[model samples]
Target: MSVSFRLGILGAVGVLAAGLAHAGWLWFAWVAPAGALDPGSAAASSWMPLLVQGSWTFVLAAAVGWQLQRSGQPLQQSLALLRQQVQALEQGRFVVVEDPPAAEALPLARSLNAAVRRLQSAIEEAPGQGAQALRRTARRDAATGLDSRFTFIARLTERLADRGGAQTALLALRLLPVQPGLAPDPRALAAAAEMLHLFSRRVPGAFVGRLCESDLALCLPAHDLVAESAHSLIAALGSGPERLHCVVGCADHLGGVSLGGALAQLDLATAEAEAAGVGALVCRTSHREEATPQEEGALRRQIVEALRANAMELAAFPVVDAQGDLLHLECPMRLRLSPGQPLAPAQAWLPVAMRYRLTTQIELAGIEMALAASARDGLSRCVHVAAESLSAAGFVSAVRSRLQATPQAAALLWIEIAEVSLERLPPRLRNAGTVWQRCGARVGIEHAGAALLSLVRLSELELDYVKVASDFVRGVAEHAVQRERVQGLVAFVHEMGARVIAEGVDEQADLDALWALGFDGATGRLAGRQGTAEALVAPGSDAAACRDQAMSPA
Candidate 1:
């Protein structure tokens, strides 16, 4: 029943009970015990007094009944108004409806307002949720069900930023027309589809995308597929049902460089593969890349000439100690394109040296340059010695002979070997490391995470330190997984009597996180050069500002 009806019923019952009580009092006082009292007595037979008192009781009850009806009007009007507003709210109207006129209904209005506000907030956030879904949808290419090229590049950049010495490689593949024809090949679509399917299936989180009609690229995470393994997998596609003829170009994000360099390496490798012939996978592993053996020889001749003439610039990045003092300068060789072409750096040429077994020569040359620079500046300097160079015959004898011949210069030198190359440490390199230690040149490993093998035998090797790979320290500040991994590595290295240095510290925040995680030293774009520790600010000291202004968005 309605609230007004229920209230009306209650009020009517109270009035009826009052009227019955009044009638009962009149009967008891005037009519009861009439026979025992004197007939002429004023109290027993006086009708006028009883009549007056009865009349007053009836008048007072009538007055009270009228007052009750007047008071119930306001309550009835409020309840009716509230009912309409509630119905309106239920029909999806977000407007704040007027409250009941009665002040007592304020509590109900306030509760309804609170509920409406909660729903409104949910409605407000709904678009942002939709935008996030839209963004995810846009990242994928419709044809291959793979990431779009833009998305792929974005992810690669993030991976590069986070590559704490971890390996990441890109595969650029072009589907060649199997049948020699002017029109479209019947096998073209099938071949591209088959290629993408195999790649996505093999690499767990592979980001594969088509750049154009038949130009496709796949980015393989280090944890999944290194460049060599990726090369092998694509080679497997050659024997598949599609029976496709293709050229694959593989480029690895080996070290610090611009995004363009990583992509250009893919282009060079693809060009080289195309020139090699059908079903070939060629990679540009060094600074100098060429399409043919003759062209490679020409580039190699230029490199040799430059190395002999010393036509190269030394770009030294400082590695800082825990105290924010300069520990050593990591001198990377920047060789010219054609002795004076200026643009190409050693990164572009080192792969050529590696390919042709000329790393020993390059290493010897780089060391001489580093030691000269170190002696001239009176600061300790370190140079990378390629793993291939370490494996070369008589490499130890040459290095030892040079060190012995110039002990003063060697004392201020440090040598670094790629950790990936140390998976099978040569006896000669180990012996050479001991000799270098005797000569006061500290030997260490760069990119030291042993993803392929255990570091349980690291103690057996002669090493002064092992740098945590660039990937581990790339986003260490915000990545819990990386932070925990680096923490364990630092402890393990310390236990093994080797110091831990974090590489790829591209931001002040990452640097701060590495320092907090117990690393002995840090180096990257953020780590300042000699005599300047100004940029190694603590995490809370406007770290976000430093991140925003200094580094590109990852």
Candidate 2:
């Protein structure tokens, strides 16, 4: 039954056969002839030869058995090693056999190692293809490839109920029917939608949706881009003489209201725009405070005043590991637009800052704050850099000069770029990432996984880590499909030599799920405090709130 037992039986049979052959030879060569002359002499001669043959057989059998056992050891060890590697592969771990136990196993090992390399390559290079698959499975409006009305409403409702009391701006566009009862031309409608899609892509955290056959809506959180974006759309449409009649309206949502109420107020603004004529834009506050050019001019003045007074505020929220050990503090920028007003986060004033070409200045100010805090507190601090600042002529050099000045603080700083920026401007991001890394600060991308194709580009940059977008992290706890996607993302990022962190992880279930999925770190409501702005800008407080809101359904 056993190999050893079978071998022993065959060895014993071979030895007995050898002895019989020797006895026969002795009988025929001497005993047979002698038997005719003297029978007793022949028998005695055969017995002597047989005894010699038996002795040799025993020696040969022992030597052969010992040799077989000695030769099998390497093979046994090789088989065990192969089994372990296979088990690791089954567990979603890519591994290779670096050294074969026996010379004969070399070919098998090489083959397995090649397979592992291929798998790693596929994961590292196939993000775009994978994202296409995700898009196919996700719900989207066919014409515009944006969120459907129902989907948009659901996400908007969620943002409205956010415990963080996030501030949002809701913008709606209406394409009027040509005749009283006739619908707009399909070609014209499609063109307008395409234009809106392009606009949405430019805004870092803007959500656009096809609200109906004749209406499209956009949501901007902690964003003041409603008026600017609406005017841009109207102007873009007006460029063509044959453009359709369009009206745009936006309203600020400071929370504590129903979706219906927000929509009603938005409707009022749209009606006002429609009355102004084709290609008109209007803005209203939740309480019907009109946003006029005078207010706009006043905001510009306030921005200048704040910057002159050095009113940039930085708040640090902790990013932690599974053991609750601090990894780094995520610092979101805030500013005091008016002397007496509570500080406002980037989302509220960034559009105005960018309009005035002050984004680079604000970003540099935030970096300085983060560096100072890191040095003072002896804790690593992170600051996000806007895409606009990266392209600003002297932004990088300015930061570089500052980092060079305070080597210790630079060592403790982490700079992050939005994932969208990386996708659109890989070369620029790479250049910035390289500069920052050389200056001793870590560089990475946040709000990642929005563009899976960007993963391939990550190899082009010197990234230390990437933060998974909150959209992917929000409901991973109970959704198997989402968990699978997250798992794949983790593996790809790990293979590319960058750690993965989860963003917007505000729930315990999501946190536990992320840990199980192998996230390096996480930051959100549950991971640590919401920092100073959220604490100071209480939901109902009269503080000037700047809320950042963007919702992309996965």
All candidates' TM-scores? 0.49, 0.51
lDDT of 1 by residue, 193-226 (tens): 5566676687676667764445678777652244
Q: Which number leads on lDDT?
A: 2
- Candidate 1 positional error at 166, Å: 18
Off by over 4 Å in 2: 1-290, 426-429, 529-554
Q: Show where candidate 1 strays beyond 4 Å.
A: 1-199, 202-290, 337-340, 450-452, 529-554
Which lDDT value does model 2 have at 30? 51
- The candidate 2 region of ten consecutive residues with least summed lDDT is 545-554
- lDDT for position 150 in model 1: 41
lDDT against the true structure, per candidate, is 0.60, 0.68
The whole-model C-alpha lDDT of candidate 2 against the native structure comes to 0.68
